[model samples]
Target: MEEEIRVEFTKNGFDFDEEEVILKKCLSFCINYKLSASDIVSSWDVYSLNRGLELTVRSSHMGAFLEQLQNEQLNKVREKESGLHLYSNDVAMILDGEYEEVKEDMLDTPTSKPASANKQPSDSTGKISGSKFSSGKPQESVTPFGQRKSKFAVQSSLNENHIKQIVKVEDHTNSEDDIIKRVRPNQKCTMRIMSSQPKPGCRFMYDRIDDKFNFLENRIKKQAISYVSAGICDEPSDPSIASQKSIFAVGMICCEEEGRLKEKPVLLQSSVEHSGGQRVRLDFQKLNQFSVFPGQVVGVEGLNPSGHCLIASKIIDYVPLSVDSSDDHPSKRQAMDQNLQMTNLSLDVPELSLIVAAGPFTTSDNLFFEPLNELLAYARRKQPQLLVLLGPFIDSDHPELKKGYMNCTFDELFQLEILGKLRDYVEYMGSAVHVILIPSIRDANHDFIFPQPAFDIHPADFNHQIHSTPNPGTFCANEVKVACCNVDILKHLSAEEIFRNPQGGSKHRMTNLAKHVINQCSFYPLYPPAEDVPLDYSLAHEALHILSVPDILILPSDLAQFVKVLSLEARNEGERQIKCICVNPGRLARGEGGGFFAEINYKGNPDSSSASIIRI
Candidate 1:
């Protein structure tokens, strides 16, 4: 057999023209070696800077031929300065001796070593047979993530006997004998097939391909258990509430509505109590006959248990949920038929709402303006009445001018319309919304300089509209109160200016600080009220309390890390109170790229002794 030397180039983020130069350089190096068509085995490929070209020889003796060619070329480069420069600066030859071992097995047989069943590397002198070059070291085998696997580890599991067994199984598909043969644990094989087998003399037919292909079906089933634990069970309309035989009954109901399937009503039974203040259960197997839709918030009546899920024999109706909106009419349809609603809520509705924006705006629009608009729009439509703006909206560190695409200047941007426009926007939106501005590091009065009025605000705008003072704080919305603070001391000023500042040289630092604060509040845990400290109680009540606050709290997006930290805290608190903390569906859905707003509208919570239909 002959040899094949593939030429490849290596470059990272190289422009189109630079690649062309590398190709030309490699050609020049080959010509200098006085290599000819007959001497060349086949083709030489070009790889980028990072990926090198591979050379394969057609015969064992070809290794010597390649080594001779490499030396001849190096001699030519050393002769002329121009050639030397090209060799040193542009092209480098990979020595042939290093590939002496590789020259054996990889080469098409008879001429070199014969192929082996196992493709692991073998001991070869000063060379590698089937190895990959990585950072100057030869790797045994590389994982999908590019890390090398152990060279001594077993490379292949299947043997000739296994291959023969697999062939036999394939030929006997759908036959009882075939099914038994495939599942025999001691049989030599690379794969196992499992399925419910029919009794002897009983006729049975199955899709053999599906059974064979889905060999690891049990493994797949085990993996899906987590999703089930995460409450990803199927839901339909008018779910059943009772089972034919349920010991701890929640309730029972039949579906007589239009397009409904008439079957045995589901029995919702559970061993866990509604520790979240309601009578909720852990399992709904008894209620499986019920036609509970996916979004339905059904109740279960059951006793407590340990280790395993409690069984709920009865199903309670969904709960009533609504959002506070200032507008006279609801904008979207609440999911009433099932249990998913899109009700809009008010910022002042005694439930906590938040709007966060920060300064030194990197986006096209000023940082404060966008969030302010959202707050105002949300307030007007769903008047919760209270709105909180977390922190620094104006940036004093961002530059005003660009020298070119690469050069920028933040010196003059704050003195221009940037600060003035922000103040006006805040005042305009503040008339209808209650804001609690948290000062950030980039604040104008905090070391970084800015015009005096830039931090000043009209007293009328600060009156009942902002939460800048201490104590239990101030409240514009019912049942919800807010407190505001700054990252640094620039006190005795209106709360509105904390988030509104000009951009400057230290803009990046300021932005990061403001983000930290916002994220903290977003994921703040609800410390349990002492009265609710039972060991088995769920944290649902406390979580709902935090969520139910109507005040809109604003913070920076950069605080995402702190928010995650807070989530961990919440999880811990929840574990102590409840056996397991039910993750907020809204939060989970959003993490999965679902829409921002989640709404729920329930008919009402059913009386503990009975059950009723609640439209959500």
Candidate 2:
């Protein structure tokens, strides 16, 4: 195959000395274009000989080579633009440049349009024309606030026949068993709130404030000591010890004053108080890279000759995951397995299916919650055993809520709009479907703090099927242990993180964010959380910690939704390795349109489990 490609290239007035490199580039191009080797050779022949252009393959620069090839073909078409010819539909369109006419013709006779018409042309001009065609669809102009009018402007006037066609329910299942299974009322499920849920009147007092600040300092000190034990850093040192030459010191990053903007100069407060816990200003100008949000415990190697500002030479913000020798704990492993036997009954089920969504369920235009209605309809059709909904049920930021425009209070709005729909859904789906609701900080009707408590719903009949858990909550569905929080930690981390390695691999940012959560062993690990996130440090110890690696981690964020299976290496050699499936089911509504949700199918094994981020 390689010889054939090389010979064909030579025949077409093209030559390359590095045959292997050229072959690899050709292979990549073929894979990207979904073309076979023969197709590539044939295309090159036509492009080189008939088009009267000498094709050159740059072995080291595939992008440039392909660009040159495309430009050459376009030039040929331009040269022949004056002459009208009955070429293939694609070439003819390119020569004539009558995209609007073609689009109108196709739209006028959809059934008659050939399959080839749907194949998008590859040139830049064709892409622009295609985008223009899409934008020209019958869409109403946007409002000043960027809200779009409903696409179904004439929905009220549409007849039953038109409605039926529009809402046609296509059979999505390939087989009966592929359908989502329903949850039995007596189905064994265990929900445990691992995070501390602040009881009413538990915070805001002076004592609570003191506890929170103490919790922050203690947590940072514990983490710093752990780093020292792991040989990742030395013991904590007073900031005053920093000298003319670079010296390592461990401390928590903080602003010199409370309520200081993030742009203000940061201070490093030593965990160990010496000279009354001296605070030194951090000079990051000398550091090549670092990420230090306020309240983050980090080790810095720097100098402060005048004992005023510590010019950081390097910053280490994270401690490595601990590892231990595998051979040292056979008996301990056996005892752990025995303990697992006692708790494995709930996990005996063969399979479990769940539908997960995060909200701001209502669209920006109005509080009708059309998207929520559609999602519930979908859930009913699928009959998922578990429906896990995370919330901003009565979104604090919604225009209606902000304007105080509702006839009822925020609590009434939640009860009527959010819980009402959920109650009806569970009832309609029968006791076989269970629903779990987790609140968000942005929920107007909920407490505006982290470590939020579950909704206080006390309906007699609904108790069995409806469960509410704290914002940063955990539970077990069948054998799958799940942890979820509705905080937008990804957005926070991306904003504050400063990476030294510019050449970080092409791994997705979502994966890195998930890894950070697991590695730090905290629900909201980014310290000095995003401005909107109200973190009460009094409950920090219990509320934020990840007791054990969960089988599923749901960190719903405003960032683009994704489903990823993360494999976390065991810190202890004898410990069972943990693999977690992470999901970010994006907000249910984006502007006036619907966004996406996640569907998970879990059996016993993490590797065998499947999940999808599906658009509503």
TM-score per prediction, in order, is 0.22, 0.61
lDDT of 2 by residue, 464-568 (tens): 778888778887766568899788887666555433322232134456657777766678876667776777776666767766677789998766677777776
Off by over 4 Å in 2: 1-190, 200-209, 228-249, 255-267, 273-276, 280-292, 299-351, 502-507, 569-577
* Global lDDT of each candidate: 0.26, 0.63
Task: Estimate, for each residue in 310-415, the C-alpha lDDT of model 1 and write its tens digit.
Answer: 4655543321123211112333323331232222232322232233223332221112122233334443332223333322333333221110110111222222
Once all C-alphas are superposed, what RMSD does model 1 give against the true structure? 34.1
Candidate topping TM-score: 2
Q: Give the range of the ten consecutive residues with the poorest summed lDDT in model 1.
A: 579-588
